[model samples]
Target: MRSVFLALLVAFFATGVAAHVARSNSLRDEKLTFNPTNVHVKRLAHTPRTLTNAQRLARGLNPARPQLRSSRRLAGRGGPSLTPTTTSTSTDTPTGTDTTTSTDTPTSTDTATSTDTPTTTSTDTTTSTDTATSTSPTPTPTCTAHTGVLELTGGSYNGYVSSETNSFGEYSVTTDASEALQVQYQECDGAVSYGPINFKTLNGLSTYPYLGGIVGFSSSSDNLASNSPNYVYLGGTQESAAGAPPQRGANSFSAASGTAKDYESAIWSVDPTTGAFTAHWVNTDGTSSAPTIMVVQDAIVLTDDTFRFIQTYGDAVIVSLTFAESSSAAVPPQATSSA
Candidate 1:
């Protein structure tokens, strides 16, 4: 009887150990990919190197359909794209063949320092004028060990603001692991710390169309009660509101740690020819408190005639990515250290 009982116990322990090891191995192998979801990819007609607009017209062909709408950029919920063993893949629906109706004056102002540069290629009907200049600065907060990426456990994080004094709806973002692009944002107490009021124009590529969104974060010391763990939040884009806030606002990204762990994001928009653009952000989560700023650039088609609208934003340290029909990136002016 004793020997039989010992054999049963050994079998059960072995099974449990195997299961635990398998679970750990599975989790440890998980990673983030380079593929982006929710991305409405458009394939514009390819333009061969030999062909120029003037040459096409000279050959008795119509000039490329002129690209109308001004220019903008698409900031992102960017991370390394995940190349799936099997794979998968937003915006308005403009009917009929992609068309343009204006001329473009060429200029450039983007600097890609250890970041990506937008690549633009439009069809024969469109005329494109663009310039890109990139510079690399030194790396900060450096460490000797270059540990490669380990795991990208996509999940929810709350970014709140609760100081020794008061707290407000800070930035927060929630990302799903299964579907990378399907993200939802939330703001708790009302207007975001730097949302809505002070937004900026989108900044990315000049030719390709793109969507815009804002992601925010902050650190919390405790719940409303004043003692617990810190949390982060990646809320949705700010809506247009009543009183006009600064195109720049104030946020500390803290909740009583005597330091800073918070950040704010305000998005705005502009037009194709550099004019004012407005948007009423009907957030995915049912809030129409304020209108969000939205600027649009020349909508471009890819080699396959796919379409997208591009936008841009100010360059603050980007915490998370926001998504919207039309808006710009928010680069918060440098915040002073915690006092």
Candidate 2:
């Protein structure tokens, strides 16, 4: 009996051991077949739930108060409460999810410019010139060519005579035949009468028994007006008829012998109207001589066979005489001669 009890206990132990080994093997097989990639872990925010004082009063509960405990107090009995307290702990972790966003916008800028310019210029010029020119005058001549003829009238020799007659009716004569002797001059211009002169009525000749013949006659002017003074020059041969009574001699020719052809020569300046006369020259001897008279410019020239006399008139009167041989007596032909 006792053996039988012991065998049974051993069998019970062996069964218990088999059941334990099977449960352990099943757990190990489940752990080995599980997929870690298919397992999903959910995360939630860690927020603890709390109640306000009003909520606590509405639920007929007192408000929570802070507890002050001493360091020696037990943690299980820290404070007293008017109501049952409950505590909840969350099992959650924070997740990394980005919430910032990005965007694009626009900006502004400006530009402008300006420019200007100007210019000017000028010029000028000039010139000039000049020129010139010239001129002159002429001259006159003298008239000397004159010709005429003279005739004696109302005299003892009433005929044509050889005499030099000037252009203005004046003539030189060597003799006068009557006291009333007159001269007539004729030319292409006209004819004129010179004198009805009386030699017996002349001064210094009134006492002569016979008045002498005229030797020469001249005047200061060729043509004179009727009222002008006649500066007349007369040359004379003072004579008495061949055997007349001797007259009282008052000049160098006073000692004349009473003979038929004996004569003395004298020169007189006379006034034709009054018969007044002044004797300028007298022959000292009884010689048959006479002077040829001429008017040259303002002078009276008288030429005789041996002498020449020059008497100038106007402004100042000068008288001069010179001895000259007669050209008619010269043996040689003269280179120059005057008639």
Specify the poorest-scoring 10-residue window by lDDT in model 2.
323-332
- Please write out the lDDT profile of model 1 over residues 153-244, one tens digit for every residue: 11232221111111222222223222122111222223332333323111111121111222122112211111211122222122333233
> Candidate 2, residues 1-339: lDDT per residue as tens digits?
999999999999999999999988776445432111233322211112243655333222346785577668666866765664443333333432222222212211121111222332222222223345554443221111111122222223333221222221122332332212221111112211122111221112212312233212232222212332223222123333322322233211121211122222223233323322222323333232224333333223333421212221222222322111111111112111111
Cα TM-score per model: 0.17, 0.16
Q: Looking at candidate 2, what is the lDDT of residue 205?
A: 23
lDDT of each: 0.26, 0.28
Q: What's the lDDT for candidate 2?
A: 0.28
Candidate 1 weakest lDDT stretch, 10 residues:
297-306
Q: What is the lDDT of residue 323 in candidate 1?
A: 33
How far in Å is the alpha carbon of 326 misplaced in model 2? 34
- How many clashes in each candidate? 75, 0
Off by over 4 Å in 2: 1-179, 182-205, 209-248, 251-290, 295-302, 305-339
